[model samples]
Target: MKKITLLSLLAAFVISCADKSQAPGAAPVPLLPVATVTNENTITDSEYPASIQGKVDVEIRPQVSGNLDRVLVDEGAYVSKGQTLFKINERPFREQLNNALASLHGAEAALINAQLEVDKLTPLVQNKVVSDYQLKLAKSSYRIAASNIEQSKAMVASAKINLGYTNVTAPVSGYIGRLPKKQGSLVSASDMEPLTTLSDVHEVVAYFSLSETDFINFKSHYAGKTIGDKINHLPPVSLILADNNAYPQKGKIDMVDGQFDKTTGAITLRATFPNANGTLRSGNTGKIRLGINHDNAILVPQSATVEMQDKIFVFTLNKENKVSKMPITVIGKSGVNYLISEGVKSGDQIVLSGIDKLQEGQLIQPEKSAPKVAQIINKK
Candidate 1:
């Protein structure tokens, strides 16, 4: 009987221990990855893809018909106002000028002969040596000769002006482009073919088109601010290129179109930027950034937020340390963090990892880890 009783007690002890292991009790809650709430009235700059252009681009064309003799400037050479850029063969122009001069000299000689005849006839008429009709005829001939001299003088002037066209000079101070009509090629004044191109690059203009909705929004936001106010009073503008590299110099809003494009429902705007170093070139792509204001807000890493069917959600830890789904309103994305316009507030512990295995009210062994500092700071 004693041996049987001892065996029963040992069996009962084992069963009790097994039952105790399966009993409902407190479990260690695994520390979850979380971020602290930061209050920032951050000014987020809006960036858009833009293009850089010159204030004025001029196509260089020959003014008179001739063969191109020499292109004095190389491709991409900076030229100054009145600087000689090309030299055409002046031999033909010189010959034409010589012909005009000869015509002028002949006209002067005829005028002198007519005047001598008029003077002699006037004395003869006064002394009754010549008839009045003869004197009148000499006067008429002198007047006609005088008119001829004036016409010849005009012709000579025009010829000299045309000859001056042989030396092509830059009309403006700018950078010159490649010679479209190379040396030894024939060019004309009537043709539209450009001999070369010149553009002022000390400062550049950026042209961009915005839709009506965007235009209205911009005007509504900045109704009372001047461009200088926008530059100094607001956030600084930044430029980005097609290669995705950010341009160092900042730009300002130069102008906005007066009329909206009806067909496209858009309005064109232009911005000017200093290009003293010629780094901001014409015909290059760029982007602009403008600042907008938002009030106190909560920000969270974009990775911590999940979207489903157009709804954004974030995992939150409850009092029992259980993962719960919470909806959030994303105001804007500042770099890598999403500014929560609503829904999430300060002092909320959020789950940053192991979101895949999480369920609402499900107990978890939350392993406490530091919030992503680098990830948050990178949003700046």
Candidate 2:
């Protein structure tokens, strides 16, 4: 009985040893999608909040103080240069002009009388009918009368200018704004509020700002010796209206603020767009879309990257299919891919999935596939 039990135990031990030796050599290395990094040309858009203004924005105000007698143009009406926009009470101005004319006539009559006296005295003095002192005094009186006539003429001209001011005219071709003062309302040159505002919308300007860092990046992308040169070389930009619709006409960057705002630490830029149809107006809000082109740029899918400790990393495979976690410097984003400036270069293989389960130096079965190159043109 003891010998049979020993045989059974020996058979069990042999089976256990065979099972241990046959165990799966090791869990098959995880298989994950792999993509090759490639260099391609693409354009990415960056948007900045902007404020729109007309090419010529002017405040319409009264030059002369008087009661508003008529408002000729309605609010939001288009006007041309020299068109009459409003009429102040002209009766008072006309009366002042008449008074000036009467004074001028009176002065003219006095000048004629003075001239007659000077003529009479000149002959008398030459004939010895009066002393030379009397002639000199008459000549002085004539000079004073002539001076008075000149002064009266100046007064008449001044009155005419004031009368002309009664009819307020448009200074430029533009659209009229609100008419705060109605007919019969008193308006003056010193009034706190302007009568209205005029905006020449034949073309519109959009003003946007960029932070200090963004400005530096923007400068690096373009090739120019000066800001003005950069502006001239810059490609046309697009305007996105408040409703998120792109403005039909593209705009050009024409101006850059001379200095950064001390408070905001940002620099302002101006882009001008043609508004032949008057689609854009003053006080309109929008965004400026600036496109940056990249040539031979290395792009990587965002999904293949993992962010740790505020740094982005990717799993790159070596010749032996061993993956090593590598850090990449991202310059910008295009659709679902990232624009890589540093790190892995062209022909580099990167693991596309299951990155969370990957260790620093893990073996991966790279299921080779084409990398996703984002849409060539992307807007943000």
Each model's RMSD to truth, in Å?
Answer: 4.6, 4.7
Judged by lDDT against the true structure, how good is candidate 1? 0.78
Model 1 steric clash pairs: 30-365, 30-366, 30-367, 31-366, 31-367, 31-368, 50-286
Estimated TM-score for each candidate: 0.78, 0.81
Q: Tens-digit lDDT track for model 2 on 1-380?
A: 99999999999999999999988787788888887777888776789999999999999889899999999999999999999999999899899999999999998898898888889899889999899998888888889888998999999999999999999999999999998999999999999999999999999999999999989988888889999888888999999998899999999999999999999999999999999998888999999999888899888878889999999999999999899999999988766778899989988888877998899888888775544333322322
Q: Highest lDDT: give the candidate number.
A: 2
Worst ten-residue run, lDDT, model 2?
Answer: 371-380
lDDT of 1 by residue, 188-302 (tens): 8887778888999888988878787766666655536654443344334667777777778877776777788889888877778888988866789877766566566577777
The Cα error of candidate 2 at residue 180, in Å, is: 1.7
Please identify model 1 stretches exceeding 4 Å from their true place: 1-12, 15-27, 30-42, 125-135, 225-236, 294-304, 315-331, 335-379
Question: Model-by-model lDDT, in order?
Answer: 0.78, 0.89
Top candidate when judged by TM-score against the true structure: 2
TM-score of structure candidate 2: 0.81
At residue 136, give the lDDT of candidate 2. 88
